[model samples]
Target chain A: MGQYKITLSGEAQTAIVRHGEQAFPFECCGFLYGHENDGRFVTEAMPVANNKKGDRRKQFEISPPDYMKAEKYALGNGLQLLGAYHSHPNHPAIASAHDLALAMPYFSYVIVSVKNGKAADIKSWRLKETIEKKFAEEKVAVKHMAMFSD
Target chain B: MAKIIIPTPLRKFTANTATFETSGSNIKEAIQELTGAYNGLTRHLLDNDFNIRSFIKIYLGEDDINSLQKEDTTIANDSVISIVPIIAGGC
Candidate 1:
């Protein structure tokens, strides 16, 4: 865990895991919207279509329009587009080289490992601002909220 | 002047400025003015051929520039330009 951390709301976490399981064997990607105070506070996890052209099994792509829509949604909701989350089917929740290449600075990348259609370890990483870009592990904090009956 | 909304990731190059106002009339000229103001943003937003990078998507309002005239798309004084980077990755 590094100094960078992301706190995901309970609903956000559940959405991410459920998405990973639903998209089993293939990659699922989405946007994370929240505020950046001290650290990232993820309040929502909005799933978007995986627009990758070929070999959807090991790869995922989010179209520009979808990205714009997500950003607009965040703005409309009084939040910022903090980062993104994706699932790695049958793989570890680690940032890959391909991830490093596509990653941009100042955004958190959350990776979920789905093993056999079940969501397993979940981790987050941030791209280091250096000539040789690399991912630094980020501490994930899941905020659990108690449910109340009306 | 067109308003260019710089994404969070690229804000560092602009001295942490979130939005920039440029007097350029078209998308290309607006970007040129932006880069001229912040020299560090040149490589990140444009390629060697001075074209917008494939991974970077520039939008004139809600429409993607690719769907329009691309960099040559004329921008209104009140037009909003957004720079969105493609988010993709694999295992």
Candidate 2:
């Protein structure tokens, strides 16, 4: 809503990388959940299935059931669903045209770049407009969250 | 009456209210009541033929409408309906 940036927990960062690497030769995707602190938001990774059905390397589809399950999980842990994450194998960490279409307002999108079964880079983005034509990059800060066992 | 939980994306049309109540015997009527009460929400909630937008997922408590009774899904006095947009997107 204002000048907000994304904060990824150390665990989340590790999970994103691990998930991307594990799904190598295919795309991996998941959700991010957290709360806002002084206009900045910190979130953790909730890796859902990449259930994209066809061409797993090029596309990923997280069904509504997966989303609901994630939401329930977040609620149980006292976190909110803040955004989503996906991996682009053999590609850069950039949101594609199709990604823009599937995006709704008010959620961050974290994209991971995986090369040769290893994670190369990770970036976060948000749709800048209601009828968006593109995604604007957001600052992603990795921080250690002192919390109970995950 | 049933409680319909509105997700973030559609809050603008409801004056940014996160949840509201609608009267109906089933999910379809409950949604219709929601649209009737929120004039600006119809476009986002329905298509040209007035069907629930396919991307919108309606859940009655823990059961999805599709696996339940679909539009005919029953609604009791305390049903908590969640209207969530599918967030899956990539290519």
Candidate 3:
């Protein structure tokens, strides 16, 4: 129903893929930051620890405080909270029903598919607020700019 | 019918099902139907007053109930309601 395009630095892309590979069996989750107004153009990927007590391989959870901290940090700097990122271990990079259930409308959810402890496919999705609830894929525009902020 | 989603942590109480179908008109009614239909959910979802606990956050579609009317947020038919618990504390 609707679509979003995000610009991530090459360094930011490497951070999330590396985070996914290093976590391997466990899932890694993080938030993306960038300036906003026209569209979300993520320039940074900040990986945080997955604190979910559930199966890490299947589920990744971010505490509310972590969100607050990320928001504070992003605002303190000169950026906005663009979206979130997570790795799906041994699963395809597709938005699950669970992801859709928890997705916020304006945020890009980047899901990296890790198979056999290696990053395979990467995809971004957003929950579209159309007449019908739809999970739509977003185009990720990787920029070659120098890293904005680690 | 609106869809009420249960997070993974609470799935053990919902027979391992992640989603349930309900015909609740509002968020409060939907959650009430959820806890009432499922066993072991009443305590986790509500307090002794049967009010939704603070830690549990409900989202109607993409809007959080807190930004809406809390428990009184309206739910449309075929809406996806996510009952996400606010995971906080601990390292």
Candidate 4:
């Protein structure tokens, strides 16, 4: 299997962290839109409401309708739906058992740790193709764009 | 024939093909034709009882099948169907 990695644009990173902070005490979820070249390049982060019912502090759900919409949006913008990102309120930025159970191959799972209503650590993971169904951490590269005045 | 759009995550099971054509009359039959062509998709899309998995969602155009008659939802020749997996998880 090839090594997997994802690069997030500065704006995309800010959008993800902000969404996590805004949804403090609960999990926030969204989709990552980008294209695959040498590796995945995330240019946009589109936040979607967590549709999971009942207790949502430790879980988040992205309805199929929402995913459909995200796909359409990405296609319209000439990009691909690379994967999804979600926040872990008051928890570490790690994939839990629940995450591994629902994970699919080829999609990067980004987890953000939110501490006291603030965004902390962030990591990305991908499911291994083995029968054991395990996740391996993917290298994350954040591009900080410089504001230039011309 | 109706067109079934396979999401990226599930494309490996479909030989990396993004869309499939089926002549089934309804959603159930369409899926039957799909899984028939791609045996690897059977376990991922359906359970032991041959029911659509809870995490798998089928949409006809922009509307979810659950909003319609579900498996019985009929499809037109030009209809476009989408198979989207539920995105859910936490820490």
| lDDT by residue (tens digit), candidate 2, A1-150 | 234478888888888888988988888898888886575455578788887768888998888778767767766888777788899999998888878877766678888888888787888888775443467888777787432223
How many Å off is the CA of A95 in candidate 4?
A: 0.5
Expressed as tens digits, the lDDT of each residue in A1-150 for candidate 4 is 237788999888888898998999999999999988777999999899999997789999998888888878876899988899999999999899999889877899999899998888889999887767899898888888531112
- List the candidate 1 regions with Cα displacement exceeding 4 Å: A145-150
Q: If the candidates were sorted by their DockQ against the true structure, best first, what order would they fall in? A: 4, 1, 2, 3
Q: Over the stretch B1-91, how does candidate 3's per-residue lDDT look in tens digits? A: 9998765446657986868999989988888888889957787678789888766777777677788888888888879888766532210
- The sequence of per-residue lDDT tens digits that candidate 1 reaches over residues A21-98 is 899888999999999877789999999999999988899999988987886787688998888999999999999999
Query: Could you say which candidate leads in DockQ?
Result: 4
What C-alpha lDDT do the candidate models reach, one value each?
A: 0.89, 0.80, 0.76, 0.90
TM-score of chain A of 1: 0.94
lDDT (C-alpha) at residue A63 in model 1: 90
Residues B49-88 of candidate 4 have per-residue lDDT tens digits of 9999988899999899999999999999999999999999
Worst 10 residues of 4 chain A by lDDT: A141-150
lDDT for residue A70 in candidate 2, whole number 0-100: 75
Docking class of 2: medium
- Give the per-residue Cα lDDT of candidate 1 at B83: 98
**Worst ten in a row by lDDT for model 1 chain A:** A141-150
Q: State the RMSD for candidate 3.
A: 12.5
Q: Which ranges in model 2 have alpha carbons more than 4 Å from their true place? A: A1-4, A132-134, A144-150, B8-18, B36-43, B67-69, B72-74
Worst 10-residue stretch by lDDT in candidate 2 chain B? B82-91
Rank the models by lDDT, top first: 4, 1, 2, 3
lDDT of 3 by residue, A35-82 (tens): 766866778899998988977878888875576567567758887666
Cα RMSD (angstroms) for every candidate in the order listed: 3.4, 4.3, 12.5, 3.5
